[model samples]
Target: MTPSVKKIKLGVDVLIENDFDIIENKKILLLTNTTGRTSSGQLTVEEIQRSKKCEIIGLLTPEHGFFTTVPAGQSVNDDIIFGLKTYSLYGNSRKPDSKLLKSCDAVVVDIQDIGIRSYTYISTIFKTMQSCAENGIPVIILDRPNPLGGEIIDGNIVETGKDSFVGIAPISYIHGCTIGELAEMFNNERWLNPKNPDKSKCSLTVIKMVNWKRSMTYEETGLQWWPTSPHIPTVNAVRGAACLGIFGELGIINIGIGTTLPFQYVGAPDFKTEIINDDIKMLKLQGIHFNPTKFQPFYGMYNGKLCDGFFLTFTNDKNFAPYTSGILFFSSLIKYYPNMFDRGKLKQNSIDMFNKVTGSDAVLDALINKKSINDLRKICNKGLDNYRKLRQKYLLYD
Candidate 1:
């Protein structure tokens, strides 16, 4: 007989169910997108409004905006929603200004965070916490799962000089900590410290989810895995995101940006698919399979051009190493398409973005230098192990 899955209660649900009085009478601002909902399919904003507990003075949207319809890397303009002032954190300012915080007694953050550091939701949280800390406003984080589960820590720690919007700090590429745990780490570790020592730290209150474990993925939690962004539409996409999303920076290659597969399929119009496919097959990489295919993205890189590439499918999720896999894949591309790769397209900003996403230029250099994937994996593993030690102290769940 199969064991039944345990139902998990989201932090918002728990907060609304028992400790709503904590939010009562406070002038609150919520930082979230469409994914901010309870497991019972109730919208957080609707539930809060219906409860009549806190006075939700405003809403702050991250990269995707309130409805999550905005395109990637596009700046979202501020707008009004449900008679409340809505602020776009992804626009002019990446965080709430002092003027915005003046109206609110506290801010409630309820955004879904993919486990990867390159995703911007955590950066929003980092900025929010910093601003809130400086302004003496409290932060209440309605924590959620780390979609990829917390048990597996992968990739390299970002070096200090390469910080960008995608990578706010020196965490692993896939840090494997929940948003709540991250909040705790950010706060306690002084990761969001204000420049002024005398300024009050943001009083962080993490309303943690009930019955969720560190080993459980989004599916195992029995909670809906709302696409954290436009491209990542399913759980498989999220897994693929760990690999393809990093490769997305290579201008010569297209990581299916405008196609349905998005991060699942990687290709280039000039690619020698058969040769590259055979090369990848020889590596015998575990936990993933590559299939040769052709595609034309309606938008983004190589738009409207038929491109040959491979579709990556994760056959064994647990054994997959996205960062190392990306390095290997990139190496193969470089080797086969040395003249066609046109890596010079990666200008300063693009180079920084690539380094920021992968957490170091070491991976890129290793691939370019034709180092063995084993050597590259070892280098990444050392950094990952160090990060794991740093992250272990901050984990909230088993």
Candidate 2:
């Protein structure tokens, strides 16, 4: 029999070790959610509550609320839960006010990120850092593995001036860096000075993960999976959504809130599965295959109607580049179904949101102009180069 490998400790471990030293006699605020857990499935909030030297002052939550109960696009408000005043950072106001930061000496952030640009959790981290910087508070980040791994880069780079809650900055769709590494990049390269306008003020410290490699996926880490958002129910959903998410720009709605496969299926009463399946084959995407099938979503787009489409299945995660997979899927859909693929018919919100998530207008333009997937590949590569240069300055791993 083969011996089981041991799971490595994440950034939370490092943060706990240094918690007494850094947070001694100080009031600390924790920015986290229900998914923020230690190797043994212990919550960060529970750990901090029992700490001897640290006083946990409050909680700051991102989209989906602290427990991750709220669905996507829903705003959360301030409430008291687990005996602490929890502030909704994902509410109508995305940033923490000065009043919220006034009582905290330092803020500890520990959120699991899905290695995608539009996930919104990373932007919450950025906003928290900005708040702490302005108020002269320090931020300590408990880093975790980028579940999609750290070596692969995909999709087009987000263009400047299109920053939103989804795509917060100019980064590749599947940014290969962890949340901590991204914070470092945003501060150093992007010049996000949290404290003084004339001087960089946000003091940041990252608790690095142990035995985590750039090439390993979440399964390799031996960590239990938790849905970072409501739609991404499984690891496969993460992989498939990264590809199918491209169709979001085309106004093809996934089974709305009620369906099990949120971003995995696309449906319209008039939709044909054969067209999408053929496009998938033409792209020659590796490590995955698509199966054309029919589904009737309980709610959301094309509800109560049998919709035709395929669910993406990955044969090998190692070779799957989700960002490329997504672009190829969208580009192929545009090429084959020119009549059904109406560039003008797509909602303005969809175009803006997709562009924001993708980080540029080039993708929409390419699909509209019937540009080759090769053009998207080139754009993806350019974004990768830029990200690589910026990411090196913040890496804490060997």
Best TM-score among the predictions, by candidate number = 1
Model 1 scores worst on lDDT over the 10 consecutive residues at 339-348
Specify the highest-lDDT model's number.
Answer: 1
lDDT of 1 at 285: 73
Residue 377 displacement in candidate 2 (angstroms): 2.2
Q: On residues 1-398, what C-alpha lDDT tens digit does candidate 2 reach at each position? A: 01354457888876676675767788988999988999878898888778767888889999988878788778888989789999899886787888878878889998888888888899998888877777878898888988778876676667667777788877788888889889888777634653357445488888888888787767777788888777776777777667766565556555323467766665556655676676678778787777777778886666677777666666645657787777666667655468544667777887777777777787767667777777877765666777767777777764
Which clashing pairs does model 1 show? none
* TM-score for all models, in order of appearance: 0.93, 0.91
lDDT string for model 1 (1-398, tens) is: 01466678788988988858769989999998888999877778888888888799999999988887888789988999877889999999999999989889999998888888898999999999999998989999998888788776778787767777888887888788999888888787776864566553579998988888776766777777777788988877887888778767656578878898778888888888998888888777776788888888999888899988888887545666776677677777767666533456456676666777776777767655667768877767756777777888888887
Error of 2 at 134 (Å): 1.6
Give lDDT per model, in order. 0.81, 0.76
